[model samples]
Target: MAEVKLKNLTKRWGDFVGVDNQSLNIKDQEFLVLLGPSGCGKTTTMRMIAGLEDPTGGEIWIGDRKVNDDLPKDRDVAMVFQNYGLYPHMTIFDNIAYPLKVRGTPKDETRPRVEKAAEQVELTQFLDRKPKALSGGQRQRVALARAIVRTPKVFLMDEPLSNLDAKLRVTMRAELKHLSRALQITTVYVTHDQIEAMTLADRVAVMKHGIIQQLGTPDEIYNDPANLFVAGFIGSPAMNLINGSVRDGMFVTTGGTRLTKLPTADRARAILGVRADDMSVHEAGQGDIDVTIYAFENTGESTLLTVQWGKQRVIARGDRHLRKEQDDVVGISLDPDHLYLFDPDTEQRIRM
Candidate 1:
């Protein structure tokens, strides 16, 4: 187990900067996730740490040594790519044993290590089969077992679960989480999927345009976003951002409806943010504001109501059994304790 550190790390192609100067410290045995949309430089940052890509400027340190000049093999880290890079002709046992073989572990020492790694990932039953016979999830486990077969100092996984189907991804996520906890290895995971980051990370670094926008635990990133982009990015339905202004301590929507009271001073422009689960739905005129429902969706677990608030629409997660239809009028109320205010011009959060 080791701590991974990036100090003023950067990557650039001519004028295009893939990773702007960024610095982060991932603790020993910590599961850190780099999360953002595509082209946000999360993968680039991980590549630098893995020795797959060199930094344009800055340092990459793993454990007590500076690994900026080391080759990938010398860096002592295992990587699991998105494609589950397994050899087609090798049996499951051979695939898992490749790392140990390359490093020249004795023939007698190899079998038990491979078997132990396979057992950790629950692949013991299929060791005799080849990669072609295994399902996608099983193939992913093989890749994982291969990585763990060597006990490298650090583990770098770049969207390792992205190729699997949705259900498979969830199952693999649990397996990955369990494995990480049991192994206690430092891991840096890259993914654009918010759900993945929220579920697997001990700490999440939300990035954009090659810059880390916010670094926090799941709860902090979800409940206490540092900026408009983070508040809008981390949630499933995302936080509903409504354009408006603050006047005399009251937040007024663009359509002239005073939505809620703000403790801050009056401002000409502001943005109101509230999550779907934070807002409640009710009969027309029963809650804070009455609006016509534009669309109603039943997602089995819960119902979602997209209601019109002036020219803007806000989605509210309703009880699963609650029924509503398009154009139906329903009252919407914001959870004052859960509300967020942001400065429109700066796109930064405002202290409540």
Candidate 2:
């Protein structure tokens, strides 16, 4: 219900900088996700927003008020951590009602609100159960219900589903997205899982080495990454970075296969960046460069095929029916419209 903003926010431990000068504006009632690999400063950024970790320098604004010195409880935000942080001795009902109790709400008023929260998370039947009695997903739901009962302006979640099984995590991902939409609370979720960020966030901020690499909607981030790090990070099987040189408006690979460069303003210096799904495979032919198939993995609906052209390996997602095997020869063609061009030296996206 409230917008969250960070202005030149930074965090450092001695000489080691955890988060650099990062400025981001999370819109009111928007579901924004901070995404990156480990040690990328995502968790540090979230903790700073939740008032758990103080920033080395910069300002944090919640709604319209500056809250750099505010306590976590005074920040009007609820956090659901990876560990759930439930009191194992307390029943689910009491756990959900703890926030209201701390606020000194009368017991009569706390019960219905707690029950309503439990119902919202579909944990009404497990109200009397302890954390030890509930499954991992159920415990996560209990944690969610506890956070929801307070009805805070913002919700912060740090890899809340990482502890669950893969199947359970997928199920909970959908549930959390639906729950956030229904509650319409400003949410800031942190996770290293690209798929989770892609599926759940309205906009994802991809970070690396304490800096934001790119900030965009899922489709934008997936289709049009800002730099090579984001281009390599946001996709499954990752995008293929074929090292080639531009000559006469065409890209010449090391294996001697030449493909016409897509018409760009800076066609003189453009490196070919192609996504695995954007490349099509055909039967081996004269114009096709002979590639040694490194591996082919069947992933239910599609197959991930890895091919080595000289020393560089590139991946292509092909149809499940394409009977390719290790050491097989295949012909590949890049989808020029979907191709990304990057500066060879800086690795930044070249405007086309």
Candidate 3:
């Protein structure tokens, strides 16, 4: 395994730039995820690294050698794609052994390697079955087994679990994490799903419009986002961004309601971002402010109360047993330590 370095790398198709001039160093044995929605250049960047797509400019170095001219096979990177990319005609054992066979490994040596890889991914029992006979998750494991059959310099996964069901995705995520650690291979994973990126990556590079918004550990990106785009893009239900102003250490809503006291200085206009989990729901008049519940949801693990705060609806997480009607009044308390202030004009974090 080796580190991947992109030096001012770029990709373009006529007028549209898929990847801007960006440089990133993926440490050896690091699991780096390029995360964003579609058209954000995450896949394109991975394709370039795999030699599947030629970059419009800049250089790519895998360890000490520049690999811009190397073909996908010569780059020595194994890719597990979303579709599983298995050969329907071949059995699972053959599929796992294909890479080694193509490279002309001795017949005796190839068999043990194929069996070991299959065993590693828990596919030893399915070796005799064809791709068409296997389930989606099983087929994805075959793809993974195929990739691991060879000790490549880098491993690139393009949303390998996206084709599975939600429950299976979670299961496969755990399997992927286990396999990655056990193999200790340099990996670059691309995905539109924030949950996957947050769960699997050693570090995540959040992308938007072909430019990387921020790159950091999952905790850093979640707790200390760089800007509005990152804060809104990284969460599940998304962070509540309330339009307001900061005056004398207080965040005032547009409707003249004093929501909470901010630690930052006065600002004419600011976006107050608070996650639902960061705000506690309490009985009426028991917390910072009272608001009418717009909607109530019980998600098994917890309850969500969408409350009307001056025309804006803010979601506050309640205990699993907490019950309230749509018209019921409740108190919401914002955790000032977790609240974030962003500049409306610049769309950047205030960092106060």
Candidate 4:
């Protein structure tokens, strides 16, 4: 396996820019994820690396060779797409064997390689079945098996789980994680799903508007976001960004409620960043601020209480067994150790 490098990489069409001068280093055998919303250029960046899209500027290096002019097939990269790019008429075995067959591998070399790849993805029993006969998850595994059959220097997966149902997506995530570790191949995964990025990535590059907002491990991006975009985009419910100002070492909300004390110096305009998990729910008047519940949700694993806090509604995570109704009064206190401050003007975190 070879490490992939992008130096000042950029993609442009006319005056519109798709990827704006982004540089990344994906180490060999590393599972790196490019995470962001649609049209954020994550897909375009991967396409450029695959030689499917032309870059306006910059170099792409795989191992010791720069592959800017290489064809997609010549780049030694296998890509699995969201739609499970497979032939409906071909048996699962044939699909997995396609890459080797196309590359002119001997018939003797093809069968065992295909069979081994199919077994790795738990598709051995379904090898004789065509893609149309398999479930969504099974089809995706066939796609993965096809990729791995090549044992390419790098694997590019683009939202390979988005088409699966929620439960199957979860199951596939675990399988994908295990497959990645076992293969020990460099992989670049693209997805807008924060949960996938958090669970699957060794390190995540969070992107927005064609720019990388933050690049770090899942813990660093979640617990210590570099900017407003990362803080808001990286979480399920997103970090609550309350409009406020810091006065005399205390943060005050727009409604004149002094929310929390800050260790940083005073800022005339700032945003207080806190996650739902960082706030503890309490009985009425038991915590720092008392407010009425705007909405209550029970999501099996945990309960979410959206409470009216001054002029804004804030969501707080409650114990799974905790039940509450709308209009119920409750108090929520912030975890001071996890609180984050950001400059509203620049959207950058204010570190003490």
RMSD (Å) of each candidate, 1 decimal: 0.9, 1.6, 0.9, 1.0
Q: Write down the lDDT of every candidate, Cα atoms only.
A: 0.94, 0.89, 0.94, 0.94
State the lDDT of candidate 3 residue by residue for 1-352, as single tens digits: 8999999999999999999998999999999999998999999999999999999999999988899999988999999998988999999999999999999999999999999999999999999999999999999999999999999999999999999999999999999999999999999999989999999999999998889999999999999999999999998779999999999899999998999988888989999999999999889999999999999999999998898999798888899999889999988899989999999999999988
Model 1 TM-score is 0.98
Give the TM-score of each candidate: 0.98, 0.96, 0.98, 0.98
Is candidate 2 or 4 superior in lDDT? 4
lDDT of 4 by residue, 1-352 (tens): 9999999999999988999999999999999999999999999999999999999999999999999999998999999999999988899999999999989999999999999999999999999888999999999999999999987999999999999999999999999999999999999999999999999999999998889999999999999999999999978788899999999999999999988888889878999999999999999998888889999999999999998888998889999999999999988899999998898989999997
Q: Which pairs clash inside model 3?
A: none
lDDT of 4 at 20: 95
Model 3's TM-score against the true structure: 0.98
Model 1 bad stretches (over 4 Å): none
Residue 83 in model 4: lDDT: 99
Tens digit per residue, CA lDDT, model 2, 159-244: 99999999999999999999999999999999999999999999999999899999999999999899989999988888888777
Model 2 compared with the native: what TM-score?
0.96
Model 3 residue runs over 4 Å out of place are: none
Q: Write the per-residue lDDT of candidate 1 for residues 1-352, one digit (tens) a residue.
A: 8999899999999999999999999999999999999999999999999888989999999999999999998999999989999999999999999988888899999999999999999999999999999999999999999999998999999999999999989989999999999999999999999999999999999999999999999999999999999999999898899999999989999999999878889889999999999999989999998999999999999999988899998989999999998999998888889999999989999988
Candidate 1 vs 2: which has more lDDT: 1
What's the lDDT for candidate 4?
Answer: 0.94
